[model samples]
Target: MTVFLRLSAAAVTAVASCQAVGALAQEVEPSDRATTDRLEEIVVTAARRPTTFQDADVSVTVLSRIQLEQARIRDIRQLDGVVPNVQFNESGQLGSTFISIRGIESNPFIVNRAAVYIDGIPFRELSNAVLNQVESIEVLRGPQATLYGANSESGLIVINTRAPTDHAVYEGRFTTTGFQGGTSAMIDGFAAGPLSETVSGSLAFKASTSDSFLRNIQPGRPAGEIRENFLQGRLRWKPSDALTINATAYVLDTNAPGVFDQEYLPLDVDLYNRTYAETYNGGRTIGQFTYVNDAPKKTEELETVAGLSATYQLAYGTLDAAVSYRKLSTDARGLDVELTALPTSAGQDYKVKTFWNGELRFASPADRPFNYIVGVSHYRQDDRRFLATFVGPGELDDFVPAPVQLAEARDWGAFFSANWTPTALPALTISGGLRYDRAHRSADQTAGSLDLGPAGIFVYRDASLSGDFDAVLPRASALYRVSSQFSLYANAAKGYVPGGFNLTAAQADLADQVLRYDSETLWSREAGFKWRSSNGRFRLAGAAFYIRADHWQEIQVATDEEGRLISSDYIGTDASIDSKGFEIEATAEPIDRLTLTANLGYTDARYRNLQLDADTNVSGERVKLVPEYDGYLAARYQASNGLYVRAEAALTGEESLESRGEAIQPATQTIGLQLGYEGPRWSARLFVDNLTNVRRSSGLAFRNFAFGNDGNWYAPIARSRQVGFELGVRL
Candidate 1:
């Protein structure tokens, strides 16, 4: 309603402005249809447009599907150490796996730590990019607010999925592999064709199942199995060269039949951490889609997105209109989740649904000597959660008499930004942006669905207004074209993640003990270069960057001890955290039959200034889990005999990880080896992941509180290095 009126008015004003500007502009050539694959295009998407990997002044890694498959990257969890600056952490068993890009990454569903996107869509959930369905994955380092928005303070991991094509097509693939400690099988298919003179549609689906990787940690325990299924389709209608309309729909489902548990082992014993014990069972499902009209003059996209944006190209710049809507829900069940005085009550369910965000963007075409971007955005969300509780340990088995409590929230935000490139300075660009957010949360202990006295509600509502926040970020960079194939550039930018409330509200009776500190922000500076040969046979890129983070977010230790689902806390206010790194990659085809590629990266992340609760000043604290070095080397050999072979190796450095102030997992490195053979109609592969079985914890690392006398929480978190073999023959 009112939102629509505002958008339409702005749009009309933009059209008039564009028409007027074009009347006085200089002539320029329309870009030629790029001959190289678009996927190969150096994505400036990280910055906003197509800038060479190096020319744009950002450190990044671009992994295409071909490379991923060749490296035997099967699961999202398998990405550990595959690239530098990537460390993983998972809790709540195998099914709820969570990975961190570098350290201090955010949980999209729980906090504002990092930002994730799909296509041009800013999607918060990283798990939705069906692994097998991805066309490419791009990792962007450092602050990205000049182009992308929100929580892009630390970094961003973008997935570009396969898209609709211009020609008709049919394709399918099936694979089966035996892992040392597990079994996995998969089938995927896709088709695209014309339905009429003006329309075409594409359909894609993937299905897979894998047995648990651990053995018998618990006596008589059986292996838990995990399954994934997905179906996504798109229909596009092109009525004219200038007009295209597309509608999309998708369904993704992940069901882990049972829980994968940890076995406790004593700390002093060698090979002490090893448990293939299986436990629990549950699942979850999420679905969504969108409709878009892309015209030569303007593109209109309507999405059920976390947020939305609609922009019309204008002569001076583009004018954007936007909106957003969202809803999320989760349900997990079974027995005990962890060793605690409290057990996740049986038949008890955990859930969160109803949250949405919106934003708009406008930018001038970069072709002109001077370019700029301006936009505003908003967000609103509703989260409702409930858990079960019992009287005490003795009566716990019988279940509690009723629902323990309910948590709910309603939040709002607004933001604006602009990027300017002076007309006379063709080699320089400057950007600036700002944001303001307001959030409101309410909670209740239901006596029966509607209960919670007035005072309880007041405290919740008043506390929200008590903590409003605002931020301002500015950035600048320049690219000096050293040659047609080379360029030098440097940039400095600021990015921040919004603050959040504590999980459960504390009563005024506990006043003076209330703690409040908005989380940290990341500021980064980077420099790099780009080069390519005229023959397209050789390419190279490199970049160096440093990031400083202040007030890093963390789980509040005191809150945890007080018994809450989650606590919010910021650490090291007196000291800033710093992560410095460099990445370089080269691809050269010396001859028609041979191609070589390699990428190397190094990142050093540590705490420089850490102030723990005013008195405990722990400066120089090393951020746990982030490795200092990682890289991959690969080669592809093709023969006139119609066969191709690829060999690759990846290296990951070790790090010291601890929990509850006790050293748990030590630094270790795991290497991977892959051998593949491909021909006209057949292919086969043999992969040895964790080939060294380097004993590193795969999930959360901590001492086992439940282990029998001996103490190891993560015994078989990771396999003792394993191997997998697969073969396929086309009909």
Candidate 2:
């Protein structure tokens, strides 16, 4: 990987230098007025204050709408290796997304380690429609506890949507993507304009569907597929000069066919002879010693969100308030592959979640010598789930209902942040923030089983548990300007992940141990430098960071020496993991009609003194889901005839898949190309992604067993060698 980076740097320098000389010969000198103009300043609200990116003492990455469209990114999954130190995989069992940032991972379906927000409303899950309707995305890679509170120990993601305008605006787009075994079609449109002098509204919608990638060798089984539809609307009113009100609503509907587990022949066939087997599912044999089951699996989900925000001018500053409500429902049914006794047992589950959030804030004037912001927020969330497994005339001869669980959580927090630049030190600035959060969590679960015969129903276990937690988080930072175009900054921050009650605790005797997991703490120190050229055509940023984390909560699965399942436990490790890394990002247009961009990230995260028990000491092991290095490089060229071409390449480093370093996933690289033509009102593009046809494992479920299912895994093979065409028109 180092060699690749060196070669790429040399090639880019040589080509850009040659092009610069040739273009300079054909270009004219800038006029006096043109020379005074500079690049448009990038504004951000990372610290709850509006400021230029170059003036802030934090690390952040911003992607504009134009950049997203140029990359042909349709969903959050496409952002996998594009950014530094971020890994996102939307392909997994049961249609769940896996997110990891800076060596901290979060489960999309369960507890969260990071926070995501759209238009100031917290999003518990990433819907399929979010990426297509947002105007910009900000990735802040650090503890955001001062403002975001719990669940933001790793980082935060902010999304802003395009609002209504005073003048009428509208656009429509159509696209088609084709691959070896499947094809997809998408249609999207948006319109925004004013209905009255003081009133404006905007609307956007998208509809898309795609065929499946895996082809079932057996007949009469539908291929795994996907379908989604989304709609969003917004209204803004400014009846007075000092007051403004806004309303937003969005809805998403999605259907997806889940993992396709295939079976193969084991290396040692003799082990199967000793295994027991039985006939089930209407004369079909079911057991670890038998052939695989080819049953269909599917998932369907619906999500809706509504929010309202109001802002009013105060005598000395500004006041803002907002409230939002969100609801999500999912229904899934699939074959139970892990249960070797009943290969055809149907596993069905239903889940429903609701969330409510509100906030009130006030801020002093930005130009004041001492500026400050204070805010209070409240949140309430409830979840209900039911699951059942039907044996369907197997040896078990009964339907097992694993338990119905109800979980509820409520939290509130208050924060205060201040910034100051003393009169004696005009070129130096300091900032500090403090926050306090209190939370209450509870869970209720019931377990049961039903006999198919006249034996009747049996209830085994029922229990309830509750807990409360509170914490105080703080942050401080300083920045010094060496010159107008360069600055140095350093910061120290603290973050934590909230404790929770586990719903899987069923045994009455062990309920106390299994029902509660403690919160974890993380402390980080970072320093970096920012630089920009006087011409405003070149920009560079870099950072070095070290993090110390303790009491990390992890779910570990145990098995016997023969690889047979024993138990899965959720516990807080007594050990610690230290993480250190550096990042570099640069953008330059050394020659006219050409632009170049590159970013590199490196991380070294490992566990120290990790002793699960007196007999087990697995220290110095690499953290799961964290790669050593990742990077990307791209270049684009535009001609005077409205034609453009761009090429990009991205790489991911090798990493272990499990905590004990049992399974290893190899490194992989891919390239992309695009050709497009633009006009005043219309544009068209043809693109090819994954030109190298790389097939790395995206998700894995493996164990060393005689059955051929050990090596079976799931990957988005449909995206390989993809050919796509897009057309757009504005009105």
Candidate 3:
């Protein structure tokens, strides 16, 4: 029995477009607030170990390192909502980092509902690193699959960088940033000390040059620029003290300008903040190349992570182990855009990628109440796709073409989790875990190829698909320490994602055939509560959830039985689905000199009978940005001499841009401002971002034309709304 239907009633309104830090802990965190202790400070890998934060029961959000040096955040999408429902999308790469937590997001070849870790490892691609050595950022909303497995089923972002610190001392800091019109320069610095009497390590570097904000009217030309660079180094060797070793190396060179996301406006014309110069002068009238990518797509990435963890000393406690390695590469230039869909020629497309990963883990030791963790993971990927279309003038055509997709993938997994607190029931704590995932993929399609001259006949075909997949993910949680500040929790979970193969060449491949998409699952349930107030400051938290998916995937609109109109691939899978949410985060200092932070979220996405095969219609569409009122609030003030001030406000309300079909973004609000001065080593500042240029829209790309009448002259829209200025220094 299959079902899925709903496309009437004015089509459910449209609009598409869609951090952690810790320390100085004492103890007495019912999750946060005027609690007494001084540094019990807390954390729980979102239900993995070293618990705190009201003993945790899911529903999480944290950011420290002085709140990322007071919001001067650089990557990690500005830590988005400070938490709550987590929302972030950056089709622009490097700046936004494509992520939508709480609301779960897949796409980028789907397969991650929310899972990204660093420190405890497991970072296959949450948009690949780049946060300049962060020290904290945790957001474990719901469905963390017992402990962040099974793609997390839509909740998890554990990033904890910045290690080797306890003294033997010397530190460093430096920063420079500016932006307007297109975008401009940026620099970063870092340093650490001590190599004797045990060991030490640290070093960082960042570089950027921006200038691309779409405004190419196709003429003599001017406007379009991009540049980026990064370098990193780290080493920690303990020789003894049980066992410890860490080595890290990083290098990223993305020449930027893959067209900076957009600048070639031809979709009729809307001149939005106009300005383009991403370079691509090959003269002559051309209609479109699938939105245009006239070459200029560059990428370079290098990563090496080495680890050796140990804590031995088990008289019944203390034991840990870890191992890791990863490598990746990307070379892009997609514009093979259907010869501008006959705009008379000109629309480019390209693809190239290489990936690798490995992991290992073990754990046990939490002062005993029974604790455990185990793991094994592996992944490999390779891709090469290219097709250029343009048929006219000075006559030169890849003579006509068809897709030439290629792929190589290998995945493996074995995970475990356990936690049981007994000893007179310290308030009840029982957690569980399970993971056994296996995936193997393959593909080959050289369907067509040619290099014809004198512009004429063209033909190519061979779309391929080779596959294999297996899955099993399960998790559980429970907590009821209803005192010492309050607590109550419950959880259950299951998740899966594994499907591959799709590489095509077009000449209408005989009407159409070349679309692959399958692999999706979800099952979740949750509950939560927490409060704090002992003397540390003030804190509060909340959570609630209910989700189910017996197969849920997207990327729709497939056709071709002579009816033509076949290009966008990836089909749908259905069955009643659900998503409920609630979050009310808080932090306060009231007087000591003013300091406060706030976050709020209310999410709900639906479509309970969109099954397939057995037509079961159910309308009431609303699930995409999963917005039912999101939130953020901040205020900082420190006084003991030098003056300082800070204020922030954020609100994201309005959502419903589902895919597998259609929907785009509309509805927004954003604001920020900062002023500061502090002296100890050195400090100075001034900042203003967005401020008002709130111009927002993000259905995150999904519009193409050329079928029934030139599809609006080829549509493309993705980035706009940026204001920047920053200065920082500390030593």
Candidate 4:
């Protein structure tokens, strides 16, 4: 309640201030609706067909190129507080990002509830969601299984890159950010033009490096640093008036620091690090046996993606076909502080993932009273992982060589959807879709470990497991056009995450007990409305949604008879969860030169019935990482002389970190400010993010020990306040 009050007050103050400033401004010509109407103008392809935002019955959020710049959203992590009912726990590890939508949450290290698509290519992992050379991002907030299939239980995010054009254009941008701990710089640019009468091409590049944000307490060891390079190219060919082809390729390389913060540092030493030194929840202090160890360690990553797409304009319909291939390799080394206060030694993990996918789709003409689309997609992914651990204090003595863990998966699906409008009442439209998915997965694992109780006991194990599953999902929606400017929509959808074999079962004594986990399923019902003014000066969108999920897959940690701790990454089934939320987004132009936008979201997510073990039944606990209330408010003003300024603020409500309600995270608030000037060919902007430097933990976990002076709480610190300037030029 208090968090809501604070947010209300902040929003009221901002609105009042903007109104006061607008009352004294001189009258000017009405501004271009193009800039502010970007949301209504956006056309999305989530349904395998091009549909205007207003016509799409699903709940979605669209961010255009102009909006991305105004918000300074560079990566997925920065998307926090910018959207409604959307949150993330970014562990900064390769392929480890937990995303939640309306309380549907998944483990970061195990699987994701939502799927991500780049230019119509599905990515099994979140490592490729990086923001660069992009055009637009569309986030569907409800079940989309009819078209997307698995991993769409929560929803899906579709990112479309800019296509090559016949017109010649070149654009470049440079930015540098400075803070108390470190500084970073980046250069991004792109060039697009026609190579021949029937051919066009575009190229984009980005390079950046940053000093370590952590101060190494260990002598002679370097601080954590980051370096990255990204490059992509696209070529398009128009063979005839009926056919078009495009090919794209990209390469990404990044090196970053591994495992962070052994223990919280003192306030004087690190302003960002917080501690529970004198708390009563756990008996812990900063001056324990464990100390900071910011050594010169890093995780190297490389990713390459290539794709080809062709569209043929048939006499009766349009045919689209695409194929893509992606490869990812990562090598990491870090200290293992999970078990003991003293360093157990260094640990390393090397992994490689390869993915191949193809899609074919045909859509009827949109101008007809009845429209339909039919599509089929096939994808296969293979992974190989190798791990190593070196143990010792001063010198490396004991060495554990882990066997390779391998997994191969293949999925194929076919979907058909149609839209019908009655001739008598053209304002009423009915839509429905159905999809059938079949998946085959297999795992090969060989695990090796070193025991360290009384006498050193080494163990080696091997296991193989395979599984096959099939699902049929459906979707239905209705839209009523009340008027030219207002529309009401209601939809019901179902989605699921496919089942797979557990590779970790090889390490334990009982392999069959944990060989595989079943798929989780979700059903959602939502109602929403869209409204806009004739002049595009005002826009409002809101939605109310309810979701029921079954067979939630969860990891459980328990102890064996010998007091040996064991963790099963994917074990749970038959548990249930329920979530309901409401979101409202509105934008108004109080004056011709000023635009004010505000969004409010409320979510109540809780587990229905869950059995942690034979003796414990935890029901009605809040879902992990889903906040009750989240919202943002912003104001932007532009002058006829090409001058502009903007300010925005976001508020996040309190949330529980664990399913058992053992840990909780407090509410957080952040603000941003920007000032800029634009000319014909040049533009410059100065921006400040996290203006108040709020320190809040995005996630929480348990330490290795039961209880001790060292706090048993594991929380990753987020970035602090940053101020920077960006310059851009176009030719």
Listed in order, each prediction's TM-score against the native is: 0.74, 0.85, 0.33, 0.88
To one decimal, what is the Cα RMSD in angstroms of model 3 from the true structure?
A: 23.5
Residue 312 lDDT, candidate 4, scale 0-100 = 99
Against the reference, the lDDT scores of all candidates come to 0.50, 0.67, 0.56, 0.71
Candidate 3 C-alpha lDDT tens digits along 597-698: 888887777666553223424434655545666788989776566557778888888765543223434556677777766554335566676676654444
Model 4 TM-score?
Answer: 0.88
What's the count of clashing pairs in each model shown?
12, 0, 85, 0
Q: Provide the lowest-lDDT 10-residue window in model 1.
A: 290-299
In terms of TM-score, how similar is model 2 to the real structure? 0.85
Q: How displaced is residue 521 in candidate 2, in Å? A: 0.9
**Residue 639 C-alpha lDDT in model 2:** 69
Model 2, runs deviating above 4 Å: 1-40, 91-94, 108-110, 128-130, 214-217, 257-293, 338-342, 392-401, 449-461, 505-511, 566-575, 609-615, 699-719
How much is the lDDT of residue 500 in candidate 2?
A: 78
lDDT of 2 by residue, 251-367 (tens): 888887642322222222233223322232333332222232334456688988999999998888999999999998887655443423334444556789899999999989989
Model 4 C-alpha lDDT per residue in residues 474-516, reported as the tens digit of each score: 9999999998888999999888877777655222464365567
| lDDT score for candidate 3 against the true structure | 0.56
lDDT of 4 at 516: 75
Using TM-score as the measure, what is the rank order of every candidate, best first? 4, 2, 1, 3
